[model samples]
Target: MTRCLRRIAPLALALCHLAAATPAAAQESAAAEALFDRGLADMEAGKYETGCASIAESHRIEPKPGALFTLAICESRWGRVASAFTRFGDYLALYEQMTPDQKSRQGERAKVARKERDRLGPLVPELSLSLPPGAPAGTVVKRDGRAVDGALLGKGVPVEPGEHVVSTQAPGGPVWETRIQLAEGEKKRVALQVNGASTAAPSGGISGRRTAAFVAGGVGVAGLVLGGVTGALTLGKKSVVEEHCGSAIGVSDETACDQTGIDAAESASTTGLVSTIGFGLGLAGLGAAAVLFLTEPKQGEEAAAATSRRIRARVLAAGPDGVVIGARGAW
Candidate 1:
């Protein structure tokens, strides 16, 4: 409890001693004043994010020395030392404009703000980004989605400690992007090297091999269905021929098969042949589909290079005798 009290004491003292305004609040709109009061209340309630947002909004609506001071303190509480330091610098600028009474009222707060800024100096994350020599004119650099001024290039600038994205691009040139994670007080220097590598974007929705595999699989399924139908037809015709030829051809050993029986036998033979071809083609297609689906290359140049090694498959009639299926190549 004592340690906790010690931690809370400084913030409580700062809140109590600091005047929220350097000048009277008379010039601000009722909405701004209300928001400012609400922000302060929120901070006192330990709703730091809401408080900071409200305070920032109030400042945006009406620029007040008090809101600036509050925003700096809120940022400090939020552990964004870089932003707090900058905001404190902004608050100090109003020092010169205060009346004697205002100065007296704000002196303690100014001292506290200065000390806080000094304390946060070494705990802030900084980044130094430099482009390669002779980087094209009109090149732009961005840090965490915000554009960095060209003038600040090659110089260390304070940033919030966490993950950040650094990107640079020139008109008609390649874009370079990298992510960096920083700890408290960490400093990093990055030198960007541009290259011809293109940014990877998904193409044609699905990969070529995968799409082909799906198509081949579909065809294979259709062929299998046709094969099944032809097989049933062959069986039905054979059954019909047997029914017609029943005991007549074998009893006398010389009774010629009737036209209906002969025709049925021929039809069955044709349908059986069709069924065999369909089965062979269907099996070949399904094998090809399995290979294609399983062999889809992963992302990058290696994938592009592997296209040549993909499986190739074919279905062909073996001869007048039967159908043949074949495949070759690296999967």
Candidate 2:
């Protein structure tokens, strides 16, 4: 009896601890569900802006495939076809992990996503990039300031219809750059030249430090935007909680608070954290941008560099007896 009690006691204690944790988890789940319901209602009422915001908040509170699917649908309905397409791709990635029954349940959504992708596929613009023959072995290419993956080089890459800048650089080579505009269903090929060793360098070129500062600044700006959106969501959730479980409602302590209130408060805290992060990033970005700009050379050097490349033409004529050389310069 003593031995049996020792083993059973541990099991009983473990079960008790598990049971104690259940209420908190259940409460959080309930809160997320309430937010989801509100979002759904708003979406149905065609208050899309608020509805989408609420939906995004709900997803943040508790990421789920269903919420993602709904968000995709909302984007599609709003005529954000490109955004919807991206969301649909994300949904499909998540859906692949479901069981057979779960997959069946989401079959209709999958069909809709496929249909949309196919319909939009033909209308999407693409860019085909290539480097000139005998380019430096390690030349790197970028589109819109982002590096192209090695596998994507010399292949057709899908892009939104718009103007795009393509640039390339290699060790011991000058930067080659060009800009192109693409319309829907258009495919344009761009070739990059690897400047020979003898080519003149651009005056006061952008330094590595300046480039790093610029990238950091961009990231910081993104973080700030995230913080702002999350902060607003936190405020919204807090208001909801206060309405349902304020001090006037005899819920002085969080433990005694309504489940909805608890969930909202938690969400608010999360968003506040995100907001703090965003502001931090934004400040950092501005600071880096300033410092980099200050340390980099002025516009006069760049103008001079531009002027150096503006030569007119050189003509060489070989006649029956002799050769004559003539040159024209931009006065």
Candidate 3:
């Protein structure tokens, strides 16, 4: 009795395991069938994207011949001719491996798959890529973000008709990339080259600070000349006032002044005010020019220098009384 029980123990355990697995397998099949039905309904309603997604998931869960054929049809109708062609080929291959009874049941679908595959063969687009002579070894070429087989280079490989991005990069080199659009049955050849050198910065011109410095210096010189000319005229007018009014050189008593003396004094005041304004402008302009020239940026430090130093100088107001020079800066 013990010997008999030992012999039967393994068999019973196997049966128990099989019975336990059966429900899970049945649930998966049921889920796959539901997804397949939903996919068909969605496709009928002209929702190809979602339909294809559901069908693909169904096929992944249970790779049934009917589901594969239906998925191929959905892909074809959705404009993915290459994917449909590949799926149809897969279905036909699966049909070849089916038992006689299975083959009999799938015979008509197999015929349709073969016919569609053949029809799409000539309509699919092809892409051929190549590298220039003397291209570096280990240069990787990619299409649509996936690496392309080196053996496929220079060979016309079938692809789906649409836009594709082709890029090539060598080790430690800049990536060279291009975009290509292909129509049905069109064949295109692309030659890729690695760009080893980086783009260079722009070449020489006058720096902004130097230009501003030159302008300020010019303004300063002009102001100094105006101040000198006006100063001399003021001295001549004061002499006239002193001579006509019998006033001392530095005296300000204008009560005894004649018309000539009053006019001379008024002219002197005008020239004197102008002199003061010109001198003020000259000093401010020269100081600004000096600061700008001294704080000019060195090579490769232009941006840092700009942020570090900011100086502005201008004339605020000028009139008979006096002139105002305004200067603001940060170091």
In order, candidate lDDTs are 0.78, 0.72, 0.83
Which of the two candidates, 2 or 3, achieves a greater lDDT against the reference? Answer: 3
| Residue runs of model 1 more than 4 Å from their true location after superposition | 1-28, 197-331
lDDT of 2 by residue, 236-323 (tens): 9978887768573686664455777778778888778777767666665656566555544444453463465333222244322323
Candidate 1 accuracy as lDDT: 0.78
lDDT of 3 by residue, 111-164 (tens): 888889999988899999987754677888999999999999999988989999
- Per-residue lDDT of 126 in model 3: 93
Top-down TM-score ranking: 3, 1, 2
RMSD of each: 17.6, 37.5, 13.3
* TM-score of each candidate structure, all chains considered together: 0.49, 0.43, 0.57
Better of 1 and 2 by lDDT: 1
Misplaced by over 4 Å in model 2 are 1-63, 74-83, 89-108, 172-176, 194-331
> Evaluated with TM-score, which candidate comes out highest?
3
